[model samples]
Target: MALLILTMVRTGEGSINSLGAGGLITLEERDTLIAFQDFSFDTDGWDRAIQENSLPGLGPVLDGSVDTAVERVFALPEETALATIRFDMFLNGGWGREDTIHIILGEIQTLALGWPSDNSELVTFARDGLSVLAQSALLDPIRDNHRVARYSVELAVSFPADRLTLRLVPELVDGAQSNWAIDNVSVVARGPEA
Candidate 1:
């Protein structure tokens, strides 16, 4: 006789709404999820300098460039219940140990603690209303530079609203050269699983 093992998987049925070029979304169902992805500087919805860079096979990554400060506004559809949101953050030039990055959704803080004092790889926060899925450090060994590290965060939404505002505030200890960039922003709304 032979021993056998089995595993189980579950999948939920829901709708997904993604943000368009103008940061617009249309609602479908009560559990409809929305996500925003901006890879080009052609959109005027974003209020900042959008930079373009080419990769080997990944093509171009149009990023929301922010030297000192910048902000992006997003509006949600009605009859939608938000569940999670996420985005990718990049440190272009270089960042200092004292450099701080604040991720705010509406008026709630999504980052863990305050600013990083020592050089660390990644940081995750466990908090209510919102939670940090992942955060990268300012140092990179393969790039041989302190910059060029990509940080990403995912948050669980407890408060839902019609108009959702997401802002990335970076307090750089260094000069203007140390800039922060963001791209591939997404928001999802879902109902409680059955």
Candidate 2:
């Protein structure tokens, strides 16, 4: 069997409205599912930096340049059973005085089949609307020399197979500054049969 490609959209230029319209596949039935691979963010200069040194009280600074970004890759069907999300990230760059990376899994939304309407909205991974699936922090005060800081996280969701959406946000911590980069961002789904 082959892997299903869900959505391959990029965020950062501005706010994106619908997941399916942004390249995400809409779910038709409860058993619908998809997966993602080679998710990336490459900037030309300092202009595309999402948030450099945006976090306070955190060590290291973030620099926003073409070399600074986030990358992640994941196989959903392999790590998850029934409905799971998995990803591996690589953060490369130099930390100045106070810069850090804030990796977040954005809200999840339920959409109709074919994504007929712009029913997509910012939602929570948890039903309580409080807890989130996964999040992480990257600090580089020592200037790891862009050594590919690696991270991975997995989540178990209760929503229907095809009606789920995932989002990621990377930001700088504190007012610090440094150059950051990312690569290999992916999201996949796994079921009992897989």
Candidate 3:
């Protein structure tokens, strides 16, 4: 039998706050990836308002205090293995109805034991419903009313591989916008496949 160990290789790291925009966050090295505030509405009438409130401003928003980025270490053959990802993310910004966040595993490109792959394959997990833990009531700026406050979500992802690309996406669910923060992303490599 082949013995495998799920170990963490990268954790508590983030990008240089220089790359943030579009609907993607790609990291060349083992760093924390931040999603730039880039969302749109169906109507142009709310363009200005949305841009001001939704754009994920530039800075070290996570700052290690909010999120920890972790990499996984697997003990398997060079080609076959499993990886598990866990994100202990927290929302520390002000409360608003329009705030939302998600941790996404894009795809696996290479099967090597290290990261920084040239090309990768994409795969998505199953998202059935809102995996929420807590909810509060907060003020809504756009609607000018009270909205459901923001909270945190502990997400886990299991896949078969060593190297892959992932991203964190946070958005404003309600018309009233607010900032969202993430912390502690733990990634581990599972044992060999059966």
Best by TM-score: 1
Clashes by residue pair, model 1: 34-187
- Give lDDT tens digits, candidate 1, residues 1-194: 01000000000111011212112333445555554554543434556645565221222344544444455566666554456666556665555566666777778766632224444445656666555666554433323344355555566666567767776677766535565555555576765435
Q: Give all candidates' CA lDDT scores.
A: 0.51, 0.34, 0.29
190: Cα error in model 3, Å: 1.6
Candidate 2 regions with alpha-carbon error over 4 angstroms? 1-33, 39-81, 96-144, 174-186, 190-194
Per-residue C-alpha lDDT of model 2 across residues 48-109, encoded as one tens digit per residue: 33433322222122233533433223323333344544443334543333344443333443
RMSD of 2: 14.9
- Worst lDDT 10-window in candidate 3: 1-10
Q: For residue 104, what is the lDDT in candidate 3?
A: 45
How far out, in Å, is residue 20 in model 1? 19
TM-score of each: 0.64, 0.36, 0.35
CA lDDT, candidate 1, residue 142? 28
Best-fitting candidate, measured by lDDT?
1
